[model samples]
Target: MHNIKDLRKNLDYYKKKLLNRNYNLNIDEFVNLDKDNRNLISKKEKLEQEKKILSKSKNKANFEKSKKISEEISRLNKDQALNKKKLDFILHTLPNLALDDVPIGKDEKSNKLIKKFGKIRDFNFTPKSHVEISSNEIDFETSTKLSGSRFVVLKNKLALLERALINFMLDVHTIQYKYTEVSPPLIVNEDVMFGTGQLPKFEEDQFEIKFNNSDQRKFLIPTSEVVLTNLVRDSFTKKDDLPLRFVASTPCFRREAGSYGKDTKGMIRQHQFYKVELVSVVEPKNCLIELDRMLDCAKKILDILEIPYQIVLLSTGDMGFSAEKTYDIEVWIPSENKYREISSCSSCGTFQARRMGAKYKINNNNEFLGTLNGSGLAVGRLIVALLENNQNEDGSVTIPDALKKYMNNLDKI
Candidate 1:
């Protein structure tokens, strides 16, 4: 969310920025609504002052005048409240302004490649997809029968491999990177989702949970980022606790509402998957710096696994709703003959902080804290990368040296 005062003061500037993000600002509607709301407030204050003066005089005429003033104030209050609601709706719909340095573009085609790491393996035989490499253990047919498409049931070693990857990622982030690991609730209230900029906009993409005889709306978390980043919601932290880094490995649920026919095969896009999420809370001034560090932390996972990947700076329209700037770590998928996004590191600046009411106290002043979140790595996609990239002609998969210990010293699966 943006400061309403700032949006009012720099309406043109914000409109231009939002335009790059493909949002058309209805300036006239906002201006008129704001003007009317402020006018109503002014009228109400004037009536209250009159009623105060009338109350001092005990005459019947003064009493009637005060009664009329009270009714007028009541009416104005409702008008002001309604108008403010409309204004806030507009504010909530607006996406975060892109950082000035971010590339302006409509889509990923305009995204800039920042760097590439490791070498893409040269397969002597025509490489198959993860499905073909582990058709027996992947068990897509059974999973589809059990829970429909976009779901998988890994059997035996493949299941163990998935758990090992999650553990390996958590260890790297929590132990080496100093991120505090948390096991948060899988289901969260609506406000918690809104705190991370996932609600009131992307409602269709969420898997909402319905309850009998309950008014409270709940949802299965789309990512651990929702829970991890919201730890500072409606609270103030000390300056010494500036960067609160958290890591969590949890099952994520998404409806994939917008993606009707994309990545229908394998684990590329799933309704349920495990991810080791990384979130950090910091002072706004150091947000970009922290973003760079966070990006490195995520990239380190691929480095340890010796997986080939490339980093790209997402263009304005391609960035997430809450991110002012973003970097995507796309791992090479041998089957797809291309790189697919395995992690996305983003600096949300104070966008989420404002919505979350997350603040930090310094020098007796409270300022919104900056929030950043990224996939330390998506376990499912990493699994796909591993199975396809390390597959042998004999159909066995060679485990990376870093994960061998977690995989019970088994080099091949």
Candidate 2:
């Protein structure tokens, strides 16, 4: 949400920004409505002032006109509500400005790779895709029977390995990186989704359910990002607490609405998956720096896992709707012989805080804090990358040295 004052003060500037973001708001009408509301507020204030004056004076005629003035006030109050609704509708569609450093491009192909890490593992024997080799351990048929497509049942080694990966990432983030760990609710209200800029735009990508016997709706969180970022919802904190860091391991559910037939063969994409997510709330000045720190935290996970990966700065068109800038960590998959995104780190700036009513007392002055979120690692994809990158000659998967301790010292599966 943008500042209302911005709409009134420089409607022309905001109008252009809205158009740039492809918002379909009627700029003239929106400005006119706000002007009308401002006029009503002025009239209301004048009426109240007159009433106070009349009450003090012994002017009988002025007292007699008071009833008519009170009725006008009531009518104006009703009009105020309508105008407020119009203002809210316009503000809801307004988008955050793109970061100056964000590359201007149409799509994913234009994303700039900032750096690459690790070496692609070489395999002597025929390397099977994770989908084929893990077939015995993944009961996709049962998943289909129980639910539908884009779901899987990981059994035995795969299940254990996924759990180990989640724990491994969490330990690294909390024990090593100073991020406080949290286990937030998997279901959140609509406001929480909107706070993270997921609602009013990408509703189809989420699974929503109604609360029992209530009009309230709750959606299964598409990512821990939703829960972790919304933790500051409707909050005003001291500036000294400017940077609040949190991490959580959670099961994320997504509808994946547009991807009808893509990556259906394996765990490359799924309806539900475990992800260890990182979120930070900071002062405006620190947001970009924190974005780098958060990305490093994510890269550290892949580093420890010994996975070859590269960092790509997402092009404007490929960036998430809420994100001003995004950096994707793509791990090399030997089977595909290319890099695929394993995690995405993004700085939303103050875009989310404004929507969530999250602000801080900066220098003892009120200001909205900025928010950012990124996947420390998506457990399923990381597992897929590991299996594909570290496959042994005899069809076994070698565990990375860092995760071996968490896997009870088992080096391979």
Residue lDDT tens for model 1, 53-152? 8898877778987898899899899989999999889989899999988999999998999999999999999999999989999998999899998999
Error of 2 at 44 (Å): 3.6
Model 2: how far residue 16 lies from native, Å: 5.6
Which pairs of residues have clashing backbones in candidate 2?
A: none
Candidate 2 stretches with Cα past 4 Å from truth are: 7-26, 51-64
Error of 2 at 68 (Å): 2.9
Q: Measured by TM-score, how close is model 1 to the native structure?
A: 0.97
Query: Which residue pairs collide in model 1, if any?
Result: none
TM-scores of the models, in the order given? 0.97, 0.92
How well does candidate 1 score on lDDT at residue 403? 94
RMSD of each: 1.4, 2.4
Error of 1 at 400 (Å): 0.7
